[model samples]
Target chain A: MTEDELGGRLAATAEAAVQRLAAALGAAPLAGETARPARLLAAMRHGVLGGGKRLRPALVVETARLFGRDIDDGHGDILLAAAALECVHCYSLVHDDLPAMDDDDIRRGQPTVHRAFDEATAILAGDALLTLAFDLLADPAGEPDAAIRIRLVTRLARAAGMGGMVGGQMLDLAAEGRFDAPAAPMGEAEVRSLQAMKTGALLRFAVDAGAMLGRASGADAAWLARYGDLVGLAFQLADDLLDATADAATVGKATGKDAGRGKATLVALHGVEAARRRLDDLVAEAEAVLQPFGERADALVAIARFIAARPS
Target chain B: MTEDELGGRLAATAEAAVQRLAAALGAAPLAGETARPARLLAAMRHGVLGGGKRLRPALVVETARLFGRDIDDGHGDILLAAAALECVHCYSLVHDDLPAMDDDDIRRGQPTVHRAFDEATAILAGDALLTLAFDLLADPAGEPDAAIRIRLVTRLARAAGMGGMVGGQMLDLAAEGRFDAPAAPMGEAEVRSLQAMKTGALLRFAVDAGAMLGRASGADAAWLARYGDLVGLAFQLADDLLDATADAATVGKATGKDAGRGKATLVALHGVEAARRRLDDLVAEAEAVLQPFGERADALVAIARFIAARPS
Candidate 1:
């Protein structure tokens, strides 16, 4: 796909996901909710509805669209699932930007949740958004099958929880050094492992969750998972490169902080040229994994390239 | 049940829940985890394994024991489920203790998670603990039935998410006043509403979840749910009373700060004598709701009264 076409496709998918998400967080309380606190709802909307690329949800939507079985009760069901993933992604951003964490003042051309609201609201908003991920997935309208809903919950909990994204974050902090501990020098292998858990896990699960929704055969699902793994690594590599090369305006957030923070990445280890080559190879491998799906996988192939070269 | 017998039962159940939780958070990584980051694992262990009454899990276990259905794959299954609820409860405490939130330095006579760990680690630890709740429930051994697991996830997402506990927290903060807004006056009804969402929801979910685990008949589930609601209300009311009457050492945390914090509670509205009378009524109503379970619910009854008259 051409750059413009890919951008258009991504934008369309993001718009759809946003609309679905707005409805999910609408005024009507879900069952068991006594009442929705207005301030909290506004903060949640601020954290989630604020503009971003929405790449994660697009991956989920595109992957599910590429696969078969028609398990979703409605077309919107897939979008709801995609939106759920975005909730997790957005919540991570909110918490990650807290003054106690990354301390970023801006995200996606807007003030970080803690900056826009208060620290407490940002924290609670992130918590609620994380909870909503499971809420959206397990809600009856989100999916038709109980088995699939539970599987999604399990997969998501693993990807986003202690063992996955959260654990990775802790490792990242440790590498940056604590008050008593000196910075830990991570070799390429250690850096890769840390990044895999921090960023790669959720991206991989996004694609894997889409496969579960589509009920793909075991072989097909396995291949898709492998493809997701490559895509995840490439996505992070590009992000590191973007941080190094792009200005804050271009990236729509603070840039050039990785070096200052002493964050270790392969891009930093191998130089920009090597990282560029790796991205190309990842896109190629990702496309190859989808070869068996034939021309039906074109959108996913485009998305893989897009993620690998996001800023461009 | 005498006070001594009740205390023994609660302590014994707390022991079992703690053991199950330790096993759940052991060194072995569950599925989809790359590896448990050592520092993160320690922080999570601190937040969770640092003790409390374990009352929420006790409610789950006792309620499940009261019903009849052999759905759990292993006897430990119920304990696992109970531990899951405790994870949610403990996670809330961790986040709530953050400097930006409640700013609590002590819990259960130990330094709160944030006091022991850094702010970022405490935040991540709470996030991980919350994620583990779903992980333990959906794990193959957590429950054998996908349908039941999905139900639990949905129920939990509601009880713990924006519409429930998180929402309540937001409301609590809003009432405390933001930089731009003055503290909003909350009457008894509003206070009850806020407390129900903030604290009561999860407690109610504990008993309802136990009923779910045992696959109680709809009528039985309804009655059990009613008991949970009363218990939840009574539990919060007693907590407010404790905050008003107890010293920091006795409560094992900061106490008598609710009034200073401008936290609106019925205990504040009705005074101690009236609040005590209400607690008595709440316990009576709770026991009546469990009447259908006959002597099988004696332990739960005693537990409810204990909660209402805790710190005696």
Candidate 2:
């Protein structure tokens, strides 16, 4: 598929995710034993709905689609998986934005959840969103097989929990010398390990979950997993590049904070030009692996190219 | 069984939960892509291992044992379920003690996770602990049937998520006039609803998970759920009574603050004498529901009685 052919397809997938997420949040079953849309639910909806690229869900759906999973029928079970993954992503943001964490006042150009609703509510909302992700996964309507569903639950829990995003966040803070006085400057390897846990794991799961849900086993699964790893690295590299070059307005959040905080990212260790070249290499390696799958993986390849050449 | 016969069984149950929880957190699978334990893991251990009666896990193991579940073989998978539920319980306490939430300086006679570590680490530890709950439930070895495991996951998510514990917490905050001015005076029913969500839900899940995990379907499951509901009410009422009458040292945390904050409880709505009566009634109802099981349920009945007569 050409760029023109893939036009609006990504956006369309994003839109589908947004719609499903909105429906899920809007009609959420629990109001803490009440039937009305309580303040907690409203805060959750606020944290989740509105903006962002919906990139994670796109990875899930597009990868599932590549494996011949039918999403035409109410998006099959893929949308639920997609939405559940997005919940983890969004919950991370909500917690990360707390006054105690990143202390950001705005997300997607709107007031953060804590700012809109108080700190306690934001904390509870983040907790609820995280719990909701598991709830969605365990829903009987999602995966056809209980065993597969449990596997998905375990993968997501690992990715979002210890050794994954939360653990990565702690490492990131430690690198910032939060616990020690002027912690030793981190090198590239440490930075890569940190990044792999902080963001790479979830992005990896996006593709891994899709392939697994589609029952792509053995070599087919191994190849997809490889593709996920490359894409995860490429996506984060591009994000760092955007942070280096793009304005806060363009990226829809603060920019250039890495250098400001003296944090060691690959971009900080190596120049922006080197990061760009590395990104190119990543995209090439990512695309090369999909050659075995022919045009069925065109969407996945397009997503890889898109990641390498983001909004900047 | 006589109280003399029951002897240290409750203490033994509590001890079992603590040991299992220690192993789970000590040997946590993900230190975020690292094989060694990380700061996040340490903080999680700090939050979960050092304190509390492990009542939730006891409720799980005892209930399952009543249905012939075994512990002689390393506590069986019921211990995993027990450990998993305790994680949720621990996570809530960690988050609740945050400066932005309850501003608690200590938990179980020691500094809270935030005071012991930094706020960020405490938050991350709590997140990991919560995620670990599902990880335990979804573990292939936890339950023989994948279908049964998924059901356990779903039930836990609901009990802990919105319209349950988190939602109940929001209501409690709102009742404190955090979001709205005065928020109208809460009556007995309103207080009951708030208490149910804030504490009752998880207490309910403890027995519900045990019964389901033990394959006690049909009428057996229904009776256990009813018993869970009554026990949940009894536990909270007893807690409220303690807050009203006991000193901080006995409970290992602040007491009388519930009324100081003007937080309404059944104990506050009706005087201490009335609350005690209510506790008695709840325990009776709880034990009555288990009449079908006869002597096998003596442990459960004793537990309900113990809940009504906490540290007081």
Q: Which candidate ranks first by TM-score, i.e. highest?
A: 1
Q: For residues A1-312, could you state the per-residue lDDT of candidate 2 as single tens digits? A: 777666588778777777777777777465224332279888999899867878888888888887788556553467888889999999999999998898999999999999998889899999999998998888767777888888899899888888788888888888777785665778998888888888899988999888977889788878888898899899889988877776445663343455445478788789788999999999999899989988999999998998788784
Which residue pairs in candidate 1 collide? none
TM-score (2 decimals) of chain A in model 2: 0.91
Candidate 1, after superposition: displacement of residue A222 in Å? Answer: 0.9
Expressed as tens digits, the lDDT of each residue in A27-115 for candidate 1 is 58867898898878888999999888888887887788776533244643777778888998899999999999989999888899888
Residue B225's lDDT in candidate 2: 82
* Accuracy of chain B in candidate 1 (TM-score): 0.92
The recovered share of true contacts, given per candidate in order, is 0.89, 0.65
> How many angstroms is residue A60 displaced in model 2 relative to the true structure, after the best TM-score fit?
0.6
Poorest 10 consecutive residues by lDDT, candidate 2 chain A? A28-37
* Model 2: CA > 4 A from native: A2-7, A28-37, A74-76, A246-262, B2-7, B28-37, B72-76, B246-262
